[model samples]
Target chain A: MDTRERLIESTRELLWERGYVGTSPKAIQARSGAGQGSMYHHFHGKPDLALAAISRSAEELRDRAEAAFTSSGTVSERVAAYLRREREALKGCPVGRLTQDPDVMADPDLRAPIEETFAWLTGRLAGLLAEGRTSGELHAGLDPAATATALVAVLQGGYVLARAAGSAEVYAQAVDGALGLLACHARQEPSRPA
Target chain B: MDTRERLIESTRELLWERGYVGTSPKAIQARSGAGQGSMYHHFHGKPDLALAAISRSAEELRDRAEAAFTSSGTVSERVAAYLRREREALKGCPVGRLTQDPDVMADPDLRAPIEETFAWLTGRLAGLLAEGRTSGELHAGLDPAATATALVAVLQGGYVLARAAGSAEVYAQAVDGALGLLACHARQEPSRPA
Candidate 1:
């Protein structure tokens, strides 16, 4: 890969581990095997490099989220596909991880892509829930918007719980609990015959 | 406070913002306003100071959590109260924030106190849920342990979502979504047993 590709790739890795505050231009240079002039020549500075890296990461996350949303399945099936999608549970979400970065958390320019990605993900999820409701797979009373937000929160929070506990098992259990609760809202048939 | 107290307090504040990876002994000395000799005289190194700081933050979080649990209210009431507990939102959870700290996440010593704090919190929340179940205030089917973990996860993830969005409003929406879902389990017994 070229210098720009190498730089963004290394940054995604560094940001995942060191966070925005901890990851520096020097660190990126070292990781990318690129010199000072090479880094600055390719990008203005840290913020510029970070903005590119974040946008790349956001695109990757969006692609994965879209795959989950568009995969062949019922709405409930698709939702489960998204939740049950294989993940490095302990490592957690790379883009979501950026949210905890003090520098990223502070800078609006740096934070926007991460924010928009989640907003779109949850919005798409709400749409999926709408599909479920229309198909009579879910109860009408269930709030799609609220359920979508809770779904994302549970997964994000699951990572915190799992990491703090030093196991991915806890994260899985939490996700399962949320899904189980959602299952209760699956259309409960009354005595009426169609 | 004395030099030692100053050092610990500074470490706590620095750790919350910059995290263990970004925080250095030199930085600690500067922030604490304690000279090298005084800092060394008070503590051995960063590890020593970090342990003290993590433990202190853990105790404070627990005390704060207990206040919400012990407040006069039903289970849902108590849970909502706990969810509504005033938070900086942007600064994030002092203890939960550590999970993202590379240095703290790397060293078992620093991670231990954070782990134990969340463990204690989830356990206390489980007890509250169990109490609610027995008192007919909560759904008997709800798993207290899992629910407790999910509740804590919502708060942690809410901070992440909100911060990423650069708005506490999204965080509040996510929490409201989770709380509203849980509220569905609140007892809805009809009056007049004719």
Candidate 2:
């Protein structure tokens, strides 16, 4: 990758591992192999570089979720795929983890990507559930938007539980629980054999 | 409060705000109005003091959750109450947020309280769901342990979402969604009026 890409990539890794307050410009420079002059030449400073990195990560996260949301299946199946998709549970969500950084949350520019990414995911998930409801796949009582938000929350919260316990089993259990709730409302097939 | 209590309290605030890596011994001393000498005398160092603070926070978190988990209500009602409890969503959970801190997660001693706190919460929630199943309040298909983990995950993840979007509305939506799903499978009482 080029110097700019290198800098952004390094900043993303550092931010994910150390958070904004813990990550330093010197550390970024060293990690990216971009000297002080080159680093400045590529970006104004740490925040500028970080914004680029966060935006990139946010886009990647949204794309990943979109792929799953739009995949072929019933609404619950697609959601299950998204929830059960392999993840570094111990490492946590790349974008979701940014919420823990005080500096990232304090600055509007830094926080925008994190905010927008979730909004997009929640909206897309809602759309999928709406489709499910229209097709009579889900119970009539289910609210698409509300259920979507819960699905996203469970996935994000699963990472926290897994990381805290130093085990991914809790994450899986959370996902299974959520999917089970969704399945509870699945409409029965009109002609299927028992 | 005594010098030790002040120190622990201040450390808790700092850790919640700035995380373990961002907090410093001098900063803690300044915040607590405790002298450098007094801090060392009370605790070995920053980690020791942070451990005490984290342990205190974990205990308080458990007590608060226990109140909701054990409250007199139907299964969904209690879970909804737990999720709906007023919170400073932007600030995140004291113990859950620590899972994002590398230094805390790296040290077993520092991580112990966080781990135990979540385990306790998940187990208690699971027990509640199990009770609901036995009482015929919830669907027999509901998996108590899995659903319990999902409930805890949603709360923790709700904080992350609220903090990211800088709003609590989504948090409420997530909780509503989880509770709504739970309500879908509520066993119909033959004697209850429609």
Candidate 3:
């Protein structure tokens, strides 16, 4: 509603569409309908505003994934829900797409949110998987940490495939592949007493 | 190298480091030690030169993967080799990175090499996997095409994780996770009679 909020929202949208290098302060100002003075007053500069925007996106991403993890289901089912969650596949992950931006990766201030978001996702997934193993939902030998990394990779990499091919089917195919892999680890349901 | 070759190589390096948006003709000229006239004479402009560079990179990428694929080993071993092949993980895939560039994706000519590279790679991986199933080296029920998509996604997504985390460890972890999943589908070696 206010100048600060409008500026941050605009920057986030631009970053998703064009990435860091392609996005400019001028463009942000144009998108936000804010004057140069207003933008400078709210934030020190482009990086300052970008840091705020990235942090907000990161939190939102975490919350979205958290919701998926907490959803009622088996661990794999929850993970599938997260993977199968609707996404702008061709547009790519708002947070993951930032990794490709050299400027975003170069500045520690800019990179922190992106890095933290993934680390948290991987860790949270690992925790869920460890729980699955303990409850006999997954094979006992399955490594929670490693499998979590795989899950994260599938989501991120699926975007790459889908975007490169200009087709959403590749993204879905990749998701199916990952789900199939996870299925390999499924523990058989307990046999019913005759 | 000749002027044309130098220009292409420089464009390739610039594209990898800065992407299509960040890279410019002036930067390409500085990197290649070519004059503006020489650059224009050899190619129409940035897009023309970029196409050549991307095509070359695509070929090199194929050669690199083929080495790992064709190496002496079983199906899983070869797939593992391809996955484990050393790379500049933080820099990301030369071709895969382009998909994130709006300019590259918008221009069908520029996108051709990148799209073809991944398509060829997924198909090749699928072929190898199908062979493994036929030879009983992998699970009979495994879907080779889907598994191949998973493999490609792991590599592409692993780069995103590594770059964002500013560490190759996540990439390696993701790869290991995917490989671990593949190992689940391994058919038991036939027993020998005493």
Candidate 4:
């Protein structure tokens, strides 16, 4: 990859691994194999480079979610697929992890992508749930938007729980619990054989 | 407060505001008015001091949660009360935030309290849920352990979302969503009038 791409990729990895406050420009230079002059020539400073990296991570997160949302299946099934998708639970989320970084959260430019990414995710899930309701896949009592937010929260929170325990099992159990609760809202198929 | 207490309290605050890597011993001294010698006398160093602070935070977190779990109400009502409890959403959870800190997670000593606190919380919630099942207040199909894990995850994730958005409303909405899902599992009383 080119220096610019390499810098952004390295920044993304560093940001994910060490967070904003923990990640330094010198570290980024070391990881990317780019000198101080090259780093400054490519971007204004840490925040500017970080913004580019964050935006990239946000877009990738959305794309990954979209793949699950658009995949062939019932709404509930698709949601399940998204939740059950393989992940590095111990490593935490690339975009979601940024929320814990005080430096990232304090700056509007650094915070925007994280905020927008979640908004888009919750919005997308809500739309899928609304579709489920329309197609009689989910019960009428289900609130699409609220349920969507809860699901997203479960995924994000699952990372925290798993990381805390140093076990991915905690994350899987959390997802199972969410799926079970969601199943409680699924409409029973009248024609299906017992 | 005494020098030791002040040091612990200040460390707690700094750990909450800025993570482990960001919180320096010098900053802790500055915040607590404890000199280097006093700090060293009280604890070995940064990691040692952080352990005490983290343990204190963990205990307080459990205490706060216990209040909700033990509140006088039906199972669903108590759960709702817990979800609706007021909080400093932007600040995030004291224990949960530590999961994001590399230094905290890297050291088993620092990670112990966080892991145990969440384990205790989930276990407590699971016990409450099982009680609900025994009383027939909730459906038999609900898995108490998994559901409890999800509930805790929702809370942790809610903080992440709210902090990212720079709005507590996001946290409130996520809680509302979880509550809505939970209400679906409540057993209907045939004798009660609508």
Candidate 5:
């Protein structure tokens, strides 16, 4: 891979593992085998390089979510796919995880991509939920935006719980319980025999 | 306060602000006004000092959480009190926030207090939930342990959302929404004329 590409990937990996505050430009250079001149030539500095990495990770998460959100299925299926999509649940979301990072949180420039990523996720989920309501697939009582926020909180919080306990079981259970609750609200009965 | 005590308190602050890997001994010494010799005398190293500070934080969180959990009221009221308790929601829970630190997570000794604090919280919440159940205050369908885990996640994850958005509004909404959902199954109806 090119130095630019390698630098971005290395920064992304370091950010995911050590967070923005914990990551350093020298470390990035070492991980990518890209010299300081090459690194600076491609990007201005740590903030600039980090912005690129954060934006890329944000896009990756959105794309991954879209894979499930756009699939041919009920809202429940799509939501379930969205939650259970082969996640490193214990490691947490590459972008959402950055929110806890103090350095990342302090910089609007760095935080924008992270913030927009979640806002976009919740917006997409809310849109799907709105569709579900119109199709009589969800309770009219359910507030799409609020429910979407709650759903995202559950996933993010589930990672905290799972990681604290050093087991993905807690994360899985929460997802299962949430999916079950959503499934029980199914509108149309399957024509197939029970 | 003594320099040793000051050193620890300062570390707790720094750790909360910068996390384990991000914080340095020199920073701690400067913040505490303890010379390098004094700090070394009191702490085996930065890791030792962090363990002490983290354990101290874990205890504080437990004490703080217990205050709300044991307050007088019905299940929803108690849970609400626990959720609505004075929080630097933007600052987040010192103990809970530590879970996001990779160095802390990578160290079992560092992580034990965190795990224990959450374990105690969930266990305590479970007991309260079980009490509610035994008194015919909860739906037969809800699992106390699972529900408790969900509650903790909602708070932890809520912080994530709020901090990312730079607004406590989303966190409050998630808590209120979850409480409303839980109230749906409460033995005593919520907001009835009393």
Candidate 6:
């Protein structure tokens, strides 16, 4: 890969591991094997490179979620599949973890991708849920928009709990709980006419 | 406040604002208005001071939640009240924020308070939910342990969404959605005899 690609990839890894505040330009250079000159040649500085990295991560997150949402399944099954997707639970989310970084959140330019990513995710999920309701698969009482937000939050919060306990099991339990609650909203099918 | 008290408070504020990686001894000392000699005299180092601050924050979180849980009302009412409690949503939860700090999570001593706080919170919430089930206030099908984990996760994840969007409304929506889903589990009262 070229120096620019290497730098972006390295920044993404470092940002995931150490966050923005703890990740330094020097470390990024070392990780990517790109000198100061090459880094400057590719991007203006840490902020510029971080923006690229963050944007890439956000796009990837959206792509992954889209795949999960669009996969062949009922709404409940798809939602369950998304929650149960394999993740580096102990490492936390690449994009979600950035929300905790003060430097990242304080800058409007840096914060935009994170904001857009979540908005897109929740909106997509809400659309899928509304589809489910229209198909009579989900109870009519289930509020699509609100339920979408809650579902996303549960996955995000599950990471926080898993990291706190240093155990992936906590994350699994949280997802299971969310799934069980959602199961309560499943519409019972009427018997077919003879 | 005494010197030690001031130092802990300052550390708490800094930790919340900047996280462990960004929080430095010099910054803490400056914020607390305690000199180098005074700081060293009072505590071992940054880690020592951070532990004290984290423990204090954890204790306060538990105390606040306990008050919310014990308030006079049904289980659903108490849960709703807890979710609806006033908060600096954009600023995020003091204890939950630390889970994203690599430095804090890397060390057992620093991570202990965070682990204990969530455990205590989930345990307490589960107990309340179980009581609700026993009283027939909640559906018998409800799983207390998993529901408690999901509830706590929604709150933690709600902060993530709010911070990402730079809006407290997102957080409120997430909480509202969780509450709505939870309401599905509320048992109905039996009809009164004439």
lDDT of 6 by residue, A1-194 (tens): 98899999999999999999999999999999999999999999999999999999999998889888988999998998888988898999999999999999999999999999999999999998999989999888888888899999998999999999999999998998888788877776321112
Which runs in model 6 stand beyond 4 Å of their true positions? A189-194, B189-194
Docking class of 5: acceptable
How many clashes would you count in candidate 4?
Answer: 0
Writing each residue's lDDT as its tens digit, candidate 3 over A81-104 gives 999998889999999999999998
Tell me the spans in candidate 2 whose CA falls farther than 4 Å from its real position.
A189-194, B189-194
Tens-digit lDDT track of model 6 for B1-194: 99999999999999999999999999999999999999999999999999999999999999999999999899998988888888899999999999999999999999999999999999999999999999999888888989999999999999999999999999999988888788878777321111
Provide DockQ values for all models, in the order shown: 0.41, 0.61, 0.52, 0.59, 0.38, 0.52
Candidate 1 at residue B149, lDDT?
78
**Shift in Å, residue B94, candidate 5:** 0.8
Q: Return the clash pairs for model 2, or none.
A: none
Clashing pairs in 3: none
| Candidate 2 CAPRI grade | medium
Top candidate, metric DockQ: 2
Candidate 1 has a DockQ of: 0.41
Reference-based lDDT, residue B61, model 1:
94
Chain B alone, candidate 2, TM-score of 0.95
| Chain A TM-score by candidate, in order | 0.94, 0.95, 0.96, 0.96, 0.94, 0.96
Error of 4 at A181 (Å): 0.5
lDDT of 5 by residue, A92-190 (tens): 778878877888898999989888887898889989988998888875656677667777887888888888888898887666545533443455532
Writing each residue's lDDT as its tens digit, candidate 2 over A40-148 gives 9989998999999999999988888878877888777888889898898988888999899998899999999899899989989888888888999976777888888
- Going through the candidates in the order shown, the clash numbers are 0, 0, 0, 0, 0, 0
Interface RMSD values for the candidates, listed in order?
6.2, 3.8, 6.0, 3.7, 4.5, 6.4
Candidate 5, B7-114: lDDT as tens digits:
999999998888887899999998999999999999999989999999999888898888898889887679889977767778776887787899899999999998
Residues B56-117, candidate 1, lDDT per residue (tens digit)? Answer: 99999999999999999788888889998889887778888789877788889888988898
